[model samples]
Target: MAAVTEPLLRTERMALRQVTRSDVDRLVLLNNDDGVMRYLDWRPPTREQVVAEVEILLKAYEVYPRHGQLIAELADSTFVGWFSLAVGADGPAAPELGYRLRTAHWGAGLATEGSQAMINYAFAELEAERVVAETMFVNAGSRRVMEKCGMRHIETFHVEFDNPLPGTELGEVRYQITREEWLVARTSR
Candidate 1:
């Protein structure tokens, strides 16, 4: 695995490290699992598809500043999932936060732990003015994770998905927190 330069985000249970080529095998396992992608549009990815996906992500990191996802790993170096702060289609400046983990790790607060670390990195390291997350309305687990990370629901909007999932008709909800809000929340604690 390629070492992340300088600083890294460490939670009580995991370290947020860059997703490198060395993680492709685990990536394939995670992405191909139905439990993980059930709420998303995409289905199981072939080995080749996973390879291409990794290539695309790596290239995006190379071409853009602070534009990549981190591979969440436990102290023992087991892959938990990937959490991202990538540029969103909302605009050139919009960076979206999201995560996808193996079902085995669900309901364990690992998602919130990794997410809070990235939220801090977004405001303190990347100097982002705001951070946002969106998910299908039926994804209560995801919605809770965002809320735990201090993001509040802003709106629910419908998106046309070529391969819609079960909750597609219910639309998607957006949640956000501005840097100002995050800082205040932090200090007030």
Candidate 2:
């Protein structure tokens, strides 16, 4: 068996690691949770969809060793959800940050903690030019987490979805922090 590697990122309450084949069921649960998927796909992903997504995420590691969706777990290995620092449409130099915690773990600051760690990794370890994130304008909680991570509001745009979620009319928001901004914030703290 291949030796398991250390986690990609660790925060006060989470250890973010590469998503393995074993994690698909839990990921399905997370994706299927109505509350958790509210601002996302708007419907639970089928098991096959989850499996395909995991395969794609796993392959991403080969192309970009520092980027891929990761599973988040507690010290005892309890599933919290997942996080990602992916090569965005802007390219590798500006990766996107994303996270999803089980509803049971919400409001405990885990999202903020995990997100801050991903931003730190993007700027400090990967030498990324910028880190970006987006969510529905109505997702105040996610917006606050991005703000706390030092990402400023950069854009508010809309995408026409055939079956849009309830707050889709309000548009979506983008938040970002440049490496320079991250460095300044790091020094100030």
Candidate 3:
């Protein structure tokens, strides 16, 4: 396996790069906006919280680059959001994929573009056996992105949350696509 380092990934309209401390203000704005965070854990984070989060993300890069993280940016270099492919906390090697985007960037197919790129990297470069995604059932947009990435519905599971978001009562849906499935789909295409 190759050492994971901050990798610069290009998509149709975005670039995925390492998140930096300088991104605090943009991250704060993205997190604070209720529309953008409707499916997330908390409301927008404080500037301090954003700073702390950046530190944690950066540290993770040092410890695990390939499974680390990436910040999605526009061609002009505006921060759109972030994406990650990391091992689940549970005792499994299956990589969990996730993304967050600015509300303004929604409905533009950017998520699908960025996600597909990550999916390709995971399967072809990382040689991952499978990739998985989860979203609150009501988050139709996110579900669509996962489906578009070729991940099919796997299961729905409920996990208790202290201060659950508006859609938590709906439970979460899991979606997955194995490398074999992906290859078969690609060959058929």
Better of 2 and 3 by lDDT: 2
Residue 30 deviation, candidate 1, in Å?
0.6
| Distance from true location, Cα of 169 in model 1, Å | 0.9
* TM-scores, all models, native as reference: 0.91, 0.95, 0.89
Which prediction has more favorable TM-score, 1 or 2? Answer: 2
- Backbone atom clashes (below 3 Å) for every candidate: 0, 0, 2
Q: For model 3, how big is the CA root-mean-square deviation? A: 4.1
Worst 10 residues of 3 by lDDT: 1-10
Candidate 3's error at 183, in angstroms? 1.0
Ranking according to lDDT, highest score first = 2, 1, 3
Predicted candidate 2: what Cα RMSD to the true structure? 2.0
RMSD of each: 2.2, 2.0, 4.1
Best by lDDT: 2
Per-residue C-alpha lDDT of model 3 across residues 7-85, encoded as one tens digit per residue: 4778888778777777777778778766877787666777888889889988887876766568888766667888888
Top TM-score model: 2
